[model samples]
Target chain A: MTSLTPMVAELVDYYDDGEAARHFQFRLLDQQQWPPPEPGQFFMLSVPGAGEIPLTFTQLPDQNQHWWALVRRMGSVTSALFRLEPGAILGARGPFGRGWPRPGSDQTPVLLIAGGCGLAPLVSQAERLLEMNLGPVALIYGARSPEARVLGRERDRWQHKLALFEVIEQSPGQTARRTPLDALPDVLAHWGHEPGATFMCGPEAMMTALSQRLIERGIPPSSIWLSLERRMHCATGTCGHCYLSHRYVCQSGPTFGWPELELLMQQPVTTQTPPLLSC
Target chain B: MIHYRLAELAELTRHLGRTRQVWQRSGAKEWCQADASNPPPLEAGRSVQSAKGFFFAEQEHIFEFDGRYFRETLPKPAPFALIGVSSCDLVAIAYQDQFFASDPHYQARRQQALLVGLECTVPCEHGFCPTVDAGPAARPGTSDLVLHPVGNGWLLTVTSEQGRKSLQGLNLTTAPEAMKQQRQAQLADCERQFPDDQHIRDGVQALNAGTVNASTWQQMGVQCLSCSGCTSLCPTCSCYGVQDQSADQTITRRRFWDSCLYDGFQREASQHNPSDDAGARVYRFWYHKFSDDFRKDFGRYGCVGCGRCEATCPGVIGIHSVMKRISQHD
Candidate 1:
């Protein structure tokens, strides 16, 4: 809606998430108005001399007028973002793509699954659900190790609002090295699989595997959603960098139903068959 | 339709040159934009470089950050006119018009320019515009002015009010009805000259039917050097990347054309790439052009059939070659 032009933002707060991840709070400098970002939507963050990269919103704009981004030190722009201080200024565009589906009613069951730093968007959703007084929410998170678990300081606050499960692959004090898939059955069993909406974000393989398991367990593909990440430049549909068949992940989605993901997963290259053109 | 004698057309070019830049295809492969003191003769085939960059610039500053605030750097180009654009290129521009309808940067330049289309009476060496519905003759609504060359003069059909207004001071006579018949005859004759493009039809059908297997793309990808020549010369390939450069206390964020053939185009920060294989990237590139899914959105295949990709690709994996390979191998 805002196109691809970025607005300058000043870093207002900074938080370290173990070794590989960091979170920054940026306040918009340009007074231009934009619709508030939905959870799972993202922004293109630009650091001087580094370039632009798409980062999902970890937390939406709060009362202090700050938007949060969780950065994993992966490439030039993200690595540059990790080195910035609180007073630094950067450019941001978007709040692009469709976000996760909201609950239909207060009693709707919401299950959130996140792996590693994929927890960012889910955290935002969890916070919103809590504020809305949405019922029966649960979060199942998986990390490689105990130290790799992000948002460690906020777990106490989250536990009070909704059920939170942390599955670690390898840690000295942990009894099991279960992956998200291993932990999913028990989580679903606890919920009694009462036909509620499920959302997941993580590695593609993990999401694919988990979605299939859910489908096998009688969950409708449309009722399950996942957040997708792709190499994006212009968040608008014009740039072809983020295309998945006919869909531009930046515009048509960053979030999509499991049925759509299944369609995307089935075709490795081309788009689905199109209707014939009446010349 | 108006008729302009071959000698009198130059007068119109000279008149328009007084207030705005007049761009016309010059030499064998270039568009010369300046005062039309001596306008070049209209060419028969497509120009080597399509008129894409005039609307969607090759590189543009999207915004600038001066320490504390960001400012948009929308282009403010002077009004200009493109004369003698080929039918294939005109169709491509219209296709882009729909894609960038909401993009302010593209609209900024597009609103300041006028499009003049030239119908092809003869097929170029490698073009198959007819197969893609892009044409040997300009389609209605794609261009402001349509030019059809006759024996001693040109039949200029003013399709838009802007085109009619641009000819205000020039003295032109109404074209004879016989000129329209002659133009249609010429276009039909040119259409029949196009080589057997059954392979393209077959290839597109295979692509839609999901009959072209992965191994064929792998074989084709081996020949691809990833030089980006095809994408660069393509009339409809519109992918780009953005970057920020620091200068003193200010930073400039710019967007430049990017190609899907590159592996890094779809790679994530986690080092996980959906299209990690070279063959897969090659397949995705072609799929974007021939896929039916995009047709539903853009109302046509992305390829305009100008065949410039064939002329520019060093790897010989251009549209014709790839389509031929797919048809043959399958």
Candidate 2:
């Protein structure tokens, strides 16, 4: 059986330097022991200097020769991971946290709204949906800058099954960048009219605004699921670090339906327990 | 095998002699042995510290990170008798059995431990054993042997197979009827000195009943420096952090005690901190202690009311005092 601990793996490919586009295939010499990852799961990546961080799986092919993580270089771990060469090793563990809920069926349209690096994990969701022949799927990705947009090569592969929309944060020379908040009106105008299960991820502000707008526009909170970012040290439930109220985001969710967010938004912030160390 | 009269209990340390060594957790340094005639010999009412240190050590080496490979090496398990452990800690030990021995990683150390439980003859300053229903006496089966103070000697009640073997070399005889009466009398005195159990339980309930708001936290959060002192010293708090170290062509897994009070505790890789402020940090601590889910996970309240948090707080933010203050407003 494969260990749950994060192990060192060499960086096999690099897509972009500035953008968070890198393919990490763990140095899995023995393929049989590596269990296949579920579609929407993630792993906790730990870099030497940078602390341990969470990343989602992008691809799971027939041969379990290598596992891939599509990481956006936003913080220390990803940024450090980006600097490594093809042979550079980074630590990884999991295929953790529940990913996207299984598709409902062909009758229901699948709406995938990604803001910035939010597109990283959803690409896998989109890919798996297509692999499983689950349809009809549409993707509307919003980024602060066009340069920061992810998965340009995969975009063409998904063109047949996915109706792709890449909304630039600043459509160059424009005074202000058009954030998801600004594009909400247009996104809703296009995909909002359709009745479908909408999955969203990105910065909290964008997701919060989109979720709120979608709720107001009569989208039932039950049909929408949002991926949130909370502080998580032990992506395992051990450290009270990743906890939100009674739930562990690392365990209970990095994803929650619209109905759950309604409760979370209303819940007041509270202090947490102190660290456990017996002196 | 040397027995002492009830009044002569203060002289028990004379047997320990003038050159007994005090074990310190810090490095290999040892404190000078206490003069047997100077301070009163160690009594079992309340230990200067808790039994937590015996199992869940402080500043433990979970794993070491070196380049591309990480190796996890568990410390050799140490065997020692917890001479002054209270019933509350014994119950906590029962819970620890599930946490450590139930899992493979934790069981690595727990299986090596020898638990020596003792009956509490006196109450600590903040302890309310009867209220929580965990105190004042050992629950027959939790400990290896429970030592009770008798008229002129100690009454050792052997509970487990280990208990019987531990006393093999010692000369102990079945106590007479008079000794049993004295044991009962000592227990009664402790019970009399303890306040009504209902008040402690009610106080906790009321604290739970109060509204948890930013303002309520502000009252306590201001003094907190996000230091994890309280949880570090708590006997029952069991939150931990897992780390993976990869180096030397090997991967090792590690679990370290974690606290919610620290800023990084609830930090996400995305830099979106949930308990970002002192208010949220403080709220997380109390709610985890009083909430049903926390108790359900551990099978008991995390706080043993040891007051180590009270003693170590830089701002002197006592959890009991905070609960009482919050209850007063409720």
Candidate 3:
């Protein structure tokens, strides 16, 4: 079942994907294809000396046993992870939490929104939808600037397959493109399809704003899903660090329907103005 | 279940210790390993800390990683008996039992320990067990054995098979069925003696109804120092964080008790914290204690009404204080 002890995943290779971020490919040394992770499922990565951090699977380990994660050099664990060599041994435990719900039988266009490195969680989903040849699937991604963008190679490939819109906050150095929100209307317009389901992950504000905008554009709150990031010590729900109301974000989510997440975020109300998704 | 009337409480303690390590009150608010030699009095007040540490150690090694493989470090505790655990503490143990049912490390220690519950003849200073249904007497199925102070002796009730077999050789006399009624009467009187807890009722209702103003929670958060005393003392609070340290090229991971009140408990490595607001933490703490959402999952509220948080909180945001504020706001 759930083991606190992580299985060793040797670093097969890695490459810089974005500013301070790397696309790490590791081979599951001990585990085989016993557990196949769905899109948006996360794993706990243990850096021998620096401790553990939760990362989403950009590429899940299949029969070949190659697992990929786009990890940003944020704190101690990632710092130690960045210091490792090609053959360095590390620890990984998971394929945990409720992953993104699969596309249903309904043939409604699926829209995905991601900000900065948040695109990692939705990569496989986009690929899955493309392979399935479902109604038009599109991804609207935003970054602070071109340099801050991640998964450059994936974006390049996705552009040919799906309706991909990349936006930047930087104005002068590059021709300014519409923000993710501004690009949303056009994406819907081009396809003449209102997304049956919208999946998003990013800064809290953007996700919240996007959910509200989706709702305004006549999408049900239940149809919008978001992946959350919280400090997770145990992906198994024993550690209450990832608690959101009665639910532990690590177990009940990492991905939650907008309505479900809104309920959790509203409890233990902290502000009279509005509930800040960051808190 | 079998019942026996015994003139000496020491005889039961001596019998239990013969087979397992005995832990009883060592000081007014402390419990430690002790034999039947110096048995501490079963006082009315609960210890400042609960017996949670017996099963869930405050700090323990989880796993060790050498350059190659990860090995789990499960605890192998000696068989032990916790003597004279209060009703509320027993309730809290049951709550933890359900929460850690799947955790191998917690189960490893918990399976080796026997719980002997003590019935409170009178209410403790900060207890509101009746309010939370945790009790003035041990709730059935929460303990292996139960002890009730009868008129000149003790009424020993065997609640579990473990309690029945542990005393195989001891000679005892069966109690009349009336003793059960007598015990109930004693508990009812004890419950009646508890102070008016309308505030607790009101506060819990307000919380579940989502009527308490956000600013009220914010004010309570302002007073909290994030000292973590309340959580440490709370019998059912079970949050943990893991740490890794290196020695001789091997990395050892130790899991230690963590507090949700700490700002960084939910702070991600990206510095994106969903609970960065102190008010959110304060509310989450009480919401866990009093929220109906948790009640549906745990079958009861997380707080067992031990009131350990009330005694340990330096800030006035203890159960009594927080409840008063919430109830008074309307």
Ranking by DockQ: 3, 1, 2
Model 3 DockQ vs. reference: 0.66
Off by over 4 Å in 1: A1-3, A173-177, A190-195, A268-279, B1-8
- Residue-level lDDT of model 2, residues B30-56, one tens digit each, is 212334455333345555455665566
| Local error of candidate 2 at residue B137 (angstroms) | 2.2
Q: Which ten residues in a row have the lowest lDDT in candidate 3 chain A?
A: A270-279
Interface RMSD, all models, one decimal each?
A: 4.3, 5.4, 2.2
For model 1 chain B, give the 10-residue run with minimal summed lDDT. Answer: B1-10
Which order, best to worst by TM-score? Answer: 3, 1, 2
| True-structure Cα RMSD, model 2 | 6.4
The fnat of each candidate, in order, is 0.62, 0.44, 0.76
lDDT of each: 0.81, 0.62, 0.85
Model 3, range A1-279, lDDT digits (tens) per residue? 367888888898999977999999988786544378889999888888899889998988878788889998989889889999899988888889999999885835888899888899998888788888877787888888778899999888887787887777675666655467666777678767788888998877778888998899889888899998888899999999888888988899999999988887786555333433221
The candidate that achieves the highest lDDT relative to the unseen native structure: 3
Error of 1 at A44 (Å): 2.4
Which tens-of-lDDT digit does each residue in B102-214 have in candidate 1? 88899999999888888888899789999999999898789888888888678788888888788787777777778888989999999999999999999898887877888
Q: List-wise, what DockQ does each model earn?
A: 0.44, 0.32, 0.66
Q: What lDDT score is found at residue A247 in candidate 1?
A: 86
Docking class of 3: medium
Candidate that scores best on DockQ: 3
